[model samples]
Target: MSPVIQEPAGIFITLEGGEGSGKTTQARRLCDWLTAQGRHVLHTREPGGTLLAERLRSLLLDRSAETIAPETEAWLILAARRQHVDHVIKPALQQGMIVVCDRFSDSTMAYQGYGRGLDLRTLRTMNKWATGKLAPHLTLLFDVPVRLGLSRRRGQRSSQNRLDREATQFHEKVRAGFQTLAKQEPRRMVVLDASLPLESVQRNVTTVITRWLNARRRQPRQR
Candidate 1:
Protein backbone atom coordinates (compact mmCIF):
# COMPACT_ATOMS: atom_id res chain seq x y z
CA MET A 1 0.00 0.00 0.00
CA SER A 2 1.08 3.58 -0.70
CA PRO A 3 2.06 5.77 2.21
CA VAL A 4 0.01 8.81 3.23
CA ILE A 5 1.51 12.26 2.65
CA GLN A 6 0.46 15.11 4.86
CA GLU A 7 1.78 17.51 2.20
CA PRO A 8 3.24 16.79 -1.18
CA ALA A 9 6.05 19.32 -1.01
CA GLY A 10 7.27 18.69 2.51
CA ILE A 11 9.58 15.98 3.87
CA PHE A 12 8.75 14.32 7.16
CA ILE A 13 11.64 12.60 8.92
CA THR A 14 11.52 11.01 12.35
CA LEU A 15 14.26 9.88 14.74
CA GLU A 16 13.31 6.95 16.95
CA GLY A 17 14.95 4.81 19.64
CA GLY A 18 14.78 3.41 23.14
CA GLU A 19 15.84 5.44 26.18
CA GLY A 20 19.21 7.24 25.90
CA SER A 21 19.73 6.06 22.34
CA GLY A 22 20.76 9.63 21.39
CA LYS A 23 17.90 10.12 18.91
CA THR A 24 17.01 13.45 20.47
CA THR A 25 20.49 14.84 19.94
CA GLN A 26 20.62 13.46 16.43
CA ALA A 27 17.22 14.96 15.63
CA ARG A 28 18.41 18.41 16.61
CA ARG A 29 21.58 17.97 14.60
CA LEU A 30 19.52 16.91 11.58
CA CYS A 31 17.38 20.01 11.84
CA ASP A 32 20.44 22.20 12.11
CA TRP A 33 22.10 20.55 9.17
CA LEU A 34 19.00 20.92 7.03
CA THR A 35 18.66 24.55 7.95
CA ALA A 36 22.28 25.18 6.94
CA GLN A 37 21.41 23.77 3.51
CA GLY A 38 18.60 26.32 3.20
CA ARG A 39 15.79 23.90 3.98
CA HIS A 40 13.06 25.34 6.20
CA VAL A 41 12.95 22.83 9.03
CA LEU A 42 10.56 22.38 11.91
CA HIS A 43 11.80 20.42 14.90
CA THR A 44 9.11 18.92 17.10
CA ARG A 45 8.60 15.87 19.29
CA GLU A 46 5.73 13.48 19.84
CA PRO A 47 3.46 13.83 22.89
CA GLY A 48 4.62 17.42 23.23
CA GLY A 49 4.39 19.37 20.01
CA THR A 50 1.22 21.29 20.71
CA LEU A 51 -0.01 22.78 23.97
CA LEU A 52 -2.53 20.04 24.60
CA ALA A 53 -0.09 17.40 23.54
CA GLU A 54 2.61 18.82 25.85
CA ARG A 55 0.20 18.47 28.74
CA LEU A 56 -0.36 14.87 27.79
CA ARG A 57 3.40 14.37 27.59
CA SER A 58 3.77 15.51 31.17
CA LEU A 59 1.00 13.17 32.23
CA LEU A 60 2.59 10.26 30.43
CA LEU A 61 6.20 10.80 31.50
CA ASP A 62 5.97 12.16 35.02
CA ARG A 63 6.22 9.65 37.84
CA SER A 64 2.54 9.20 38.39
CA ALA A 65 1.11 8.42 41.78
CA GLU A 66 -1.15 5.91 40.03
CA THR A 67 -0.10 3.12 37.71
CA ILE A 68 -0.81 3.84 34.07
CA ALA A 69 -2.22 0.79 32.34
CA PRO A 70 -0.74 -0.17 28.99
CA GLU A 71 -4.04 0.44 27.23
CA THR A 72 -4.44 3.75 28.99
CA GLU A 73 -0.93 4.77 28.00
CA ALA A 74 -1.66 3.94 24.38
CA TRP A 75 -4.89 5.93 24.46
CA LEU A 76 -3.20 9.00 25.89
CA ILE A 77 -0.34 8.79 23.39
CA LEU A 78 -2.74 8.55 20.47
CA ALA A 79 -4.72 11.44 21.87
CA ALA A 80 -1.54 13.53 22.00
CA ARG A 81 -0.70 12.37 18.49
CA ARG A 82 -4.06 13.56 17.21
CA GLN A 83 -3.41 16.99 18.63
CA HIS A 84 0.16 17.02 17.33
CA VAL A 85 -0.95 16.01 13.84
CA ASP A 86 -3.66 18.65 13.64
CA HIS A 87 -1.95 21.56 15.35
CA VAL A 88 1.73 21.09 14.63
CA ILE A 89 2.90 18.43 12.19
CA LYS A 90 0.32 18.77 9.42
CA PRO A 91 0.48 22.54 9.40
CA ALA A 92 4.28 22.58 9.21
CA LEU A 93 4.17 20.14 6.34
CA GLN A 94 1.52 22.24 4.63
CA GLN A 95 3.97 25.14 4.63
CA GLY A 96 6.48 23.00 2.78
CA MET A 97 8.91 22.64 5.67
CA ILE A 98 11.03 19.64 6.57
CA VAL A 99 9.48 18.36 9.79
CA VAL A 100 12.03 16.71 12.09
CA CYS A 101 10.01 14.87 14.69
CA ASP A 102 11.92 13.24 17.56
CA ARG A 103 9.47 10.38 18.02
CA PHE A 104 6.35 9.14 16.27
CA SER A 105 3.98 6.17 15.94
CA ASP A 106 6.70 3.52 16.04
CA SER A 107 7.55 4.40 19.62
CA THR A 108 4.04 3.36 20.63
CA MET A 109 4.35 0.10 18.78
CA ALA A 110 7.70 -0.73 20.34
CA TYR A 111 7.22 0.55 23.88
CA GLN A 112 3.61 -0.10 24.75
CA GLY A 113 2.83 -2.92 22.34
CA TYR A 114 5.97 -5.00 22.59
CA GLY A 115 7.35 -3.94 25.92
CA ARG A 116 4.07 -3.66 27.82
CA GLY A 117 2.34 -6.64 26.16
CA LEU A 118 -0.27 -4.77 24.10
CA ASP A 119 -1.26 -6.08 20.66
CA LEU A 120 0.87 -4.59 17.91
CA ARG A 121 -1.93 -4.90 15.35
CA THR A 122 -4.32 -2.94 17.51
CA LEU A 123 -1.74 -0.24 18.15
CA ARG A 124 -0.98 0.08 14.46
CA THR A 125 -4.65 0.52 13.60
CA MET A 126 -5.12 3.05 16.38
CA ASN A 127 -2.01 4.94 15.30
CA LYS A 128 -3.32 5.11 11.74
CA TRP A 129 -6.59 6.64 12.89
CA ALA A 130 -4.87 9.02 15.27
CA THR A 131 -2.51 10.46 12.70
CA GLY A 132 -4.90 10.23 9.78
CA LYS A 133 -2.59 7.62 8.28
CA LEU A 134 0.36 9.98 8.31
CA ALA A 135 3.73 8.26 8.22
CA PRO A 136 7.24 9.63 8.11
CA HIS A 137 8.89 9.90 4.74
CA LEU A 138 12.00 8.51 6.41
CA THR A 139 12.69 7.04 9.83
CA LEU A 140 16.16 6.84 11.38
CA LEU A 141 16.15 4.34 14.24
CA PHE A 142 19.11 4.69 16.59
CA ASP A 143 19.91 1.24 17.94
CA VAL A 144 21.94 0.37 21.05
CA PRO A 145 22.07 -2.45 23.53
CA VAL A 146 19.42 -2.16 26.24
CA ARG A 147 21.97 -2.28 29.02
CA LEU A 148 24.05 0.39 27.36
CA GLY A 149 21.08 2.63 26.72
CA LEU A 150 19.73 2.16 30.24
CA SER A 151 23.16 2.75 31.70
CA ARG A 152 23.34 6.02 29.79
CA ARG A 153 19.94 6.96 31.12
CA ARG A 154 20.98 6.15 34.62
CA GLY A 155 23.80 8.67 34.34
CA GLN A 156 21.14 11.35 33.77
CA ARG A 157 19.43 10.94 37.08
CA SER A 158 17.88 14.41 37.03
CA SER A 159 15.77 13.67 33.93
CA GLN A 160 14.75 10.08 34.53
CA ASN A 161 11.13 9.37 33.65
CA ARG A 162 8.89 6.49 34.61
CA LEU A 163 9.80 4.62 31.46
CA ASP A 164 13.45 5.04 32.32
CA ARG A 165 12.82 3.18 35.55
CA GLU A 166 11.31 0.11 33.87
CA ALA A 167 13.09 -3.22 34.25
CA THR A 168 15.97 -4.01 31.91
CA GLN A 169 13.86 -6.79 30.41
CA PHE A 170 11.24 -4.29 29.29
CA HIS A 171 13.85 -2.20 27.47
CA GLU A 172 15.23 -5.31 25.80
CA LYS A 173 11.75 -6.13 24.51
CA VAL A 174 11.41 -2.61 23.12
CA ARG A 175 14.78 -2.87 21.41
CA ALA A 176 13.81 -6.17 19.86
CA GLY A 177 10.52 -4.71 18.73
CA PHE A 178 12.31 -1.85 16.97
CA GLN A 179 14.59 -4.34 15.29
CA THR A 180 11.63 -6.30 13.98
CA LEU A 181 10.14 -3.11 12.61
CA ALA A 182 13.37 -2.07 10.88
CA LYS A 183 13.63 -5.45 9.22
CA GLN A 184 9.99 -5.29 8.16
CA GLU A 185 10.35 -1.87 6.51
CA PRO A 186 13.91 -1.77 5.31
CA ARG A 187 13.23 0.88 2.71
CA ARG A 188 11.84 3.49 5.09
CA MET A 189 13.61 2.74 8.33
CA VAL A 190 17.40 3.00 8.56
CA VAL A 191 19.01 1.54 11.64
CA LEU A 192 22.11 3.25 12.99
CA ASP A 193 24.70 1.97 15.44
CA ALA A 194 24.06 4.57 18.09
CA SER A 195 26.88 3.30 20.31
CA LEU A 196 29.30 5.00 17.93
CA PRO A 197 30.92 8.31 18.67
CA LEU A 198 28.60 11.30 18.35
CA GLU A 199 30.45 12.84 15.41
CA SER A 200 30.44 9.61 13.44
CA VAL A 201 26.72 9.05 13.90
CA GLN A 202 25.96 12.60 12.84
CA ARG A 203 28.05 12.19 9.73
CA ASN A 204 26.23 8.99 8.84
CA VAL A 205 22.87 10.66 9.43
CA THR A 206 23.74 13.64 7.22
CA THR A 207 25.03 11.39 4.47
CA VAL A 208 21.93 9.20 4.51
CA ILE A 209 19.54 12.14 4.37
CA THR A 210 21.48 13.85 1.59
CA ARG A 211 21.37 10.69 -0.46
CA TRP A 212 17.66 10.23 0.14
CA LEU A 213 16.85 13.80 -0.89
CA ASN A 214 18.92 13.46 -4.03
CA ALA A 215 17.17 10.24 -4.96
CA ARG A 216 13.77 11.78 -4.33
CA ARG A 217 14.71 14.74 -6.53
CA ARG A 218 15.34 12.35 -9.40
CA GLN A 219 12.02 10.54 -8.97
CA PRO A 220 8.86 11.92 -10.56
CA ARG A 221 6.66 13.69 -8.08
CA GLN A 222 3.60 11.80 -6.89
CA ARG A 223 0.27 13.47 -6.84
Candidate 2:
Protein backbone atom coordinates (compact mmCIF):
# COMPACT_ATOMS: atom_id res chain seq x y z
CA MET A 1 0.00 0.00 0.00
CA SER A 2 1.23 3.51 -0.81
CA PRO A 3 1.64 5.94 2.08
CA VAL A 4 -0.24 9.22 2.10
CA ILE A 5 2.18 12.08 2.08
CA GLN A 6 1.93 14.54 4.93
CA GLU A 7 3.78 17.83 5.04
CA PRO A 8 5.50 17.89 8.41
CA ALA A 9 6.97 20.93 10.13
CA GLY A 10 10.12 18.99 11.08
CA ILE A 11 12.76 17.80 8.63
CA PHE A 12 14.16 14.31 8.07
CA ILE A 13 17.87 13.95 7.45
CA THR A 14 19.72 10.70 6.89
CA LEU A 15 23.36 9.64 6.73
CA GLU A 16 24.49 7.03 4.22
CA GLY A 17 27.84 5.41 3.58
CA GLY A 18 29.72 2.16 3.23
CA GLU A 19 31.30 0.41 6.21
CA GLY A 20 33.31 2.61 8.58
CA SER A 21 32.42 5.83 6.81
CA GLY A 22 31.94 7.62 10.14
CA LYS A 23 28.18 7.99 9.70
CA THR A 24 27.39 7.38 13.37
CA THR A 25 29.96 9.92 14.55
CA GLN A 26 28.89 12.54 12.04
CA ALA A 27 25.22 11.96 12.83
CA ARG A 28 25.91 12.56 16.52
CA ARG A 29 27.81 15.71 15.72
CA LEU A 30 24.98 17.00 13.59
CA CYS A 31 22.49 16.25 16.36
CA ASP A 32 24.63 18.10 18.91
CA TRP A 33 24.91 21.10 16.62
CA LEU A 34 21.19 21.21 15.98
CA THR A 35 20.39 20.69 19.64
CA ALA A 36 22.65 23.61 20.53
CA GLN A 37 20.48 25.79 18.34
CA GLY A 38 17.46 25.01 20.58
CA ARG A 39 15.88 22.68 18.06
CA HIS A 40 14.09 19.49 19.08
CA VAL A 41 16.06 16.66 17.50
CA LEU A 42 15.79 12.88 17.53
CA HIS A 43 18.99 11.00 16.68
CA THR A 44 18.31 7.38 15.77
CA ARG A 45 19.68 4.57 13.63
CA GLU A 46 18.22 2.04 11.19
CA PRO A 47 17.84 -1.70 11.73
CA GLY A 48 17.17 -0.16 15.12
CA GLY A 49 15.50 2.84 16.85
CA THR A 50 12.55 0.79 18.06
CA LEU A 51 12.50 -2.14 20.50
CA LEU A 52 11.77 -4.83 17.93
CA ALA A 53 14.07 -3.20 15.45
CA GLU A 54 16.97 -3.30 17.89
CA ARG A 55 16.46 -7.01 18.34
CA LEU A 56 16.53 -7.40 14.60
CA ARG A 57 19.74 -5.42 14.51
CA SER A 58 21.31 -7.85 16.96
CA LEU A 59 20.31 -10.77 14.77
CA LEU A 60 21.56 -9.09 11.64
CA LEU A 61 24.88 -8.05 13.11
CA ASP A 62 25.67 -11.07 15.24
CA ARG A 63 28.55 -13.04 13.83
CA SER A 64 27.37 -16.15 15.60
CA ALA A 65 23.92 -16.05 14.06
CA GLU A 66 23.10 -18.72 11.48
CA THR A 67 24.18 -17.96 7.97
CA ILE A 68 21.38 -15.84 6.53
CA ALA A 69 20.32 -15.96 2.89
CA PRO A 70 20.61 -12.76 0.89
CA GLU A 71 16.85 -12.49 0.39
CA THR A 72 16.26 -13.25 4.03
CA GLU A 73 18.64 -10.50 5.06
CA ALA A 74 16.87 -8.07 2.79
CA TRP A 75 13.48 -8.93 4.19
CA LEU A 76 14.70 -8.67 7.77
CA ILE A 77 16.07 -5.22 7.13
CA LEU A 78 12.85 -4.10 5.49
CA ALA A 79 10.82 -5.42 8.39
CA ALA A 80 12.94 -3.51 10.88
CA ARG A 81 12.70 -0.39 8.77
CA ARG A 82 8.93 -0.61 8.67
CA GLN A 83 8.73 -0.85 12.42
CA HIS A 84 11.23 1.98 12.87
CA VAL A 85 9.26 4.26 10.59
CA ASP A 86 5.95 3.54 12.27
CA HIS A 87 7.07 3.63 15.91
CA VAL A 88 9.80 6.27 15.83
CA ILE A 89 10.35 8.33 12.68
CA LYS A 90 6.77 9.17 11.77
CA PRO A 91 5.76 10.20 15.25
CA ALA A 92 8.86 12.34 15.81
CA LEU A 93 8.38 14.18 12.54
CA GLN A 94 4.68 14.69 13.21
CA GLN A 95 5.63 16.24 16.54
CA GLY A 96 7.83 18.75 14.67
CA MET A 97 11.12 17.22 15.82
CA ILE A 98 14.01 17.08 13.40
CA VAL A 99 14.96 13.41 12.92
CA VAL A 100 18.56 12.59 12.11
CA CYS A 101 18.84 8.98 11.06
CA ASP A 102 22.10 7.06 10.85
CA ARG A 103 20.96 4.87 7.98
CA PHE A 104 17.81 4.31 5.92
CA SER A 105 16.51 2.63 2.78
CA ASP A 106 19.65 3.58 0.87
CA SER A 107 21.68 1.17 2.97
CA THR A 108 19.41 -1.67 1.93
CA MET A 109 19.80 -0.71 -1.71
CA ALA A 110 23.56 -0.46 -1.44
CA TYR A 111 24.27 -3.40 0.83
CA GLN A 112 21.70 -5.94 -0.29
CA GLY A 113 21.05 -4.90 -3.87
CA TYR A 114 24.61 -3.94 -4.72
CA GLY A 115 26.73 -5.96 -2.34
CA ARG A 116 24.65 -9.12 -2.49
CA GLY A 117 23.65 -8.84 -6.17
CA LEU A 118 19.94 -8.40 -5.52
CA ASP A 119 17.73 -6.63 -8.06
CA LEU A 120 17.75 -2.89 -7.43
CA ARG A 121 14.32 -2.30 -8.92
CA THR A 122 12.65 -4.77 -6.57
CA LEU A 123 14.53 -3.43 -3.60
CA ARG A 124 13.38 0.09 -4.36
CA THR A 125 9.76 -0.98 -4.50
CA MET A 126 10.04 -2.90 -1.23
CA ASN A 127 11.76 0.01 0.47
CA LYS A 128 8.95 2.36 -0.54
CA TRP A 129 6.42 0.02 0.99
CA ALA A 130 8.51 -0.47 4.13
CA THR A 131 8.95 3.22 4.69
CA GLY A 132 5.55 4.31 3.49
CA LYS A 133 7.35 6.37 0.82
CA LEU A 134 8.77 8.58 3.55
CA ALA A 135 11.84 9.89 1.80
CA PRO A 136 14.42 11.90 3.65
CA HIS A 137 14.51 15.62 2.89
CA LEU A 138 18.31 15.41 2.79
CA THR A 139 20.76 12.50 2.73
CA LEU A 140 24.44 13.11 3.45
CA LEU A 141 26.57 10.41 1.86
CA PHE A 142 30.02 10.06 3.46
CA ASP A 143 32.17 8.87 0.59
CA VAL A 144 35.40 7.03 1.30
CA PRO A 145 37.61 4.44 -0.40
CA VAL A 146 36.80 0.86 0.47
CA ARG A 147 40.27 -0.04 1.68
CA LEU A 148 40.65 3.06 3.78
CA GLY A 149 37.22 2.72 5.32
CA LEU A 150 37.81 -0.95 6.12
CA SER A 151 41.18 -0.19 7.62
CA ARG A 152 39.62 2.38 9.88
CA ARG A 153 37.08 -0.16 11.02
CA ARG A 154 39.73 -2.78 11.69
CA GLY A 155 41.63 -0.36 13.84
CA GLN A 156 38.65 -0.07 16.14
CA ARG A 157 38.06 -2.90 18.63
CA SER A 158 34.29 -2.55 18.70
CA SER A 159 33.66 -2.17 14.97
CA GLN A 160 33.76 -5.82 14.00
CA ASN A 161 30.40 -7.26 12.91
CA ARG A 162 28.92 -9.65 10.37
CA LEU A 163 29.05 -7.13 7.55
CA ASP A 164 32.60 -6.21 8.48
CA ARG A 165 33.64 -9.79 7.82
CA GLU A 166 32.56 -9.69 4.19
CA ALA A 167 35.06 -9.99 1.33
CA THR A 168 36.87 -6.82 0.26
CA GLN A 169 35.37 -7.04 -3.21
CA PHE A 170 31.89 -7.04 -1.71
CA HIS A 171 32.65 -3.75 0.02
CA GLU A 172 33.94 -2.29 -3.24
CA LYS A 173 30.63 -3.09 -4.89
CA VAL A 174 28.74 -1.42 -2.06
CA ARG A 175 30.90 1.68 -2.36
CA ALA A 176 30.26 1.85 -6.08
CA GLY A 177 26.55 1.46 -5.42
CA PHE A 178 26.55 4.50 -3.14
CA GLN A 179 28.36 6.55 -5.78
CA THR A 180 25.88 5.51 -8.43
CA LEU A 181 23.00 6.45 -6.17
CA ALA A 182 24.51 9.87 -5.43
CA LYS A 183 24.84 10.56 -9.13
CA GLN A 184 21.23 9.64 -9.74
CA GLU A 185 19.88 11.85 -6.95
CA PRO A 186 22.22 14.77 -6.84
CA ARG A 187 19.64 17.19 -5.50
CA ARG A 188 18.64 15.22 -2.40
CA MET A 189 22.02 13.60 -1.72
CA VAL A 190 25.27 15.42 -0.97
CA VAL A 191 28.60 13.60 -1.18
CA LEU A 192 31.18 14.50 1.44
CA ASP A 193 34.75 13.23 1.57
CA ALA A 194 34.82 11.01 4.65
CA SER A 195 38.56 10.39 4.22
CA LEU A 196 39.29 13.89 5.47
CA PRO A 197 40.15 14.64 9.09
CA LEU A 198 37.20 14.36 11.45
CA GLU A 199 37.03 18.08 12.16
CA SER A 200 37.24 18.97 8.48
CA VAL A 201 34.47 16.55 7.58
CA GLN A 202 32.28 17.89 10.38
CA ARG A 203 32.91 21.45 9.20
CA ASN A 204 31.75 20.61 5.69
CA VAL A 205 28.72 18.79 7.05
CA THR A 206 27.77 21.78 9.24
CA THR A 207 28.15 24.19 6.34
CA VAL A 208 26.04 22.12 3.97
CA ILE A 209 23.28 21.46 6.51
CA THR A 210 23.29 25.10 7.57
CA ARG A 211 22.68 26.24 4.00
CA TRP A 212 19.89 23.73 3.54
CA LEU A 213 18.20 24.80 6.75
CA ASN A 214 18.45 28.46 5.79
CA ALA A 215 16.86 27.81 2.42
CA ARG A 216 14.17 25.73 4.04
CA ARG A 217 13.38 28.61 6.39
CA ARG A 218 13.03 30.97 3.46
CA GLN A 219 10.37 28.87 1.80
CA PRO A 220 6.72 29.69 2.41
CA ARG A 221 4.72 27.22 4.48
CA GLN A 222 2.20 25.01 2.77
CA ARG A 223 -1.35 25.98 3.65
Give stretches of model 2 more than 4 Å off: 1-5, 220-223
| CA-lDDT, candidates in order | 0.91, 0.94
lDDT of 2 by residue, 1-223 (tens): 9998568777999999998899999999999999999999999999899999999999999999999999999999999999999999999999999999999988999999999999999999999999999999999999999999999999996859999999999999999999999999997899999999999999999999999888878873511
The residue pairs that clash in candidate 1, if any, are none
Structural similarity to truth (TM-score) of each candidate: 0.95, 0.95
After superposition, candidate 1 runs with Cα above 4 Å error: 1-7, 220-223
Tens-digit lDDT track for model 1 on 1-223? 9998435568899999999999888998999889999999999998789888999999999986489989999999999999999888888888899999999999999999889989889899999999999899999999999888888888989998989989899999999999999999998999999999899999999999988998888873631
Q: Mark the 10 consecutive residues where model 1 has the least summed lDDT.
A: 214-223
RMSD list, candidates in order: 2.9, 2.7
Number of backbone-clashing residue pairs for each candidate, in the order shown: 0, 0
| lDDT (Cα) of model 2 | 0.94
